[model samples]
Target: MKRPSLVLCCALLGIVPTACGPGSDPDPGVDRGDSSTVDLEHLAITVSGRAAVFPEAARLLEAQGQPVPSLDGVVLTVEEPLRVGVSDADSVLGQGGIGADGGFSVSEVPVRDIHLSLAASLQQEGFVRSSTIIFDTAFTRTRPHTDIIDARAWALPNAFHDALTRSIGDASIRAHSGERASTLRDAGFILGRVVDAAGAPVAGARVVLDRDDLAGRVYYPAPDFQSATQDGTSATGLFVYVHSGTAAETFSLSIEGTQAYLPRNAGATPGLGLVLTLYPGNVSP
Candidate 1:
């Protein structure tokens, strides 16, 4: 079979393209009952990573005097992108549990030139889940990979139930915090990256929702939250938007400015974990 162009694969990760080369199908280094796609030579890969609530969320919780959730029972998984409507059961490349220090090291993962995504979730209630595209070159068995996985909260943690009893006088902190936390739970979370045709990160790009109705409902999390209105994505070409509106909402994204890339209108649902890798002038795949 003909392989995807290097530009395409690199574009998906927002990495600079090295050159085009022959490779097998973009099958994840997973055993999905398709023995033909499994390359045993690449199975010794080791991926170590840390899982913690994002700084913004952590600060917010700390300010509220709530402790960060324990890392016990947290699970990390290495996975490959699957087609829409496809079951993920067959796409798991590897999985590991987080330690007390919120660290994880998963070995024996299948890695090649294959595109992969790392996902971390807490089995505990009210903790936000996280999934990010590797956003770099393909993982290779020649070396170990280290990653930091930042998680956040989407629901009103049971620990914060005190907010429900506070009077309307504390709306700014109590209500606002509750609103931000619940917004991520009810609506969804979106993480995006913009890249040029050659796959380098585009620094000044701004991602926007096409819906006029969602004007105030969209919010940027802390640290870089304020930057969303000023400088847009940084050199990393990363931006995050979460819904603070009522009900689950579905929408597509459009980038402002005169870039050659078209907006992705594939009905992205944030609750399902959307990590977008945008390429200029090419949105087909």
Candidate 2:
């Protein structure tokens, strides 16, 4: 009896409820159509030899993470300067700085084939150590990095190669004020930083370890290629390892955070350690 009156009253009021009703399709919110970029930057590059080994002449970048050495006047060809153009060949990103360590760096470069034309100065000391480099700007998540022999039928018994194989860097081998005979031992080095796509340090990233830089070198310190941290680690800036001798100095490091190279002169000990942080928008850490 009361049901009839209640039903009529509810129907008249038009009350609608869904506390126990079937769910419907989710609401499609208004999407502002705009393009967003991941903001990836070119992989940083570094070297540990005389200048003019990279971007000067036509030399192939052995690995994707290899640094382009600074060889400005060193010119690839006596006729043309070492042009640092993108793989697209439209605009030329500015030249990277050549530090005292004879290394060059481009903080923000597109991930593309960096061509160094040095046909004119091929025979030069450090112009074309290997060959022209073909690289990709993609972040290194899968394969780490490897050095290519870059040997051609052109030069045999390369003096530099011989010196490196014999562990005779800085042939003159001067002794600094605080340097010692142990300094001549050639303790291998490890250098790197943790960075992001926007050239920023990303801390809290587990750092990993690898020795790809030392593979195939005739000698342990065969010129360039250091090892380092590779476990999930939040970088804390330049980490240096202090070990006893050159015998145990093989550190090829890669970081989930931004990468940075520790200059040779910058370190006083044999094994070097480093940790770098990454911030949003690739800001420097």
Instruction: Tell me the tens digit of each residue's lDDT in model 1 across 146-176.
Output: 2222222122233332222121122222243
On lDDT, the leading prediction is: 1
Range of the 10 consecutive residues with the lowest summed lDDT in candidate 2: 148-157
lDDT of 2 by residue, 38-119 (tens): 2223222211122344221112243434354434433221111112111124324333333454433333333232222111
Report, for every candidate in turn, its global Cα lDDT versus the true structure: 0.44, 0.25
For candidate 1, the TM-score is 0.47
Model 1, which residues run further than 4 Å from truth? 1-40, 81-85, 112-123, 135-183, 192-205, 208-239, 242-270, 274-285
**TM-score, per-candidate, Cα-based:** 0.47, 0.22
**lDDT, model 1, position 150:** 29
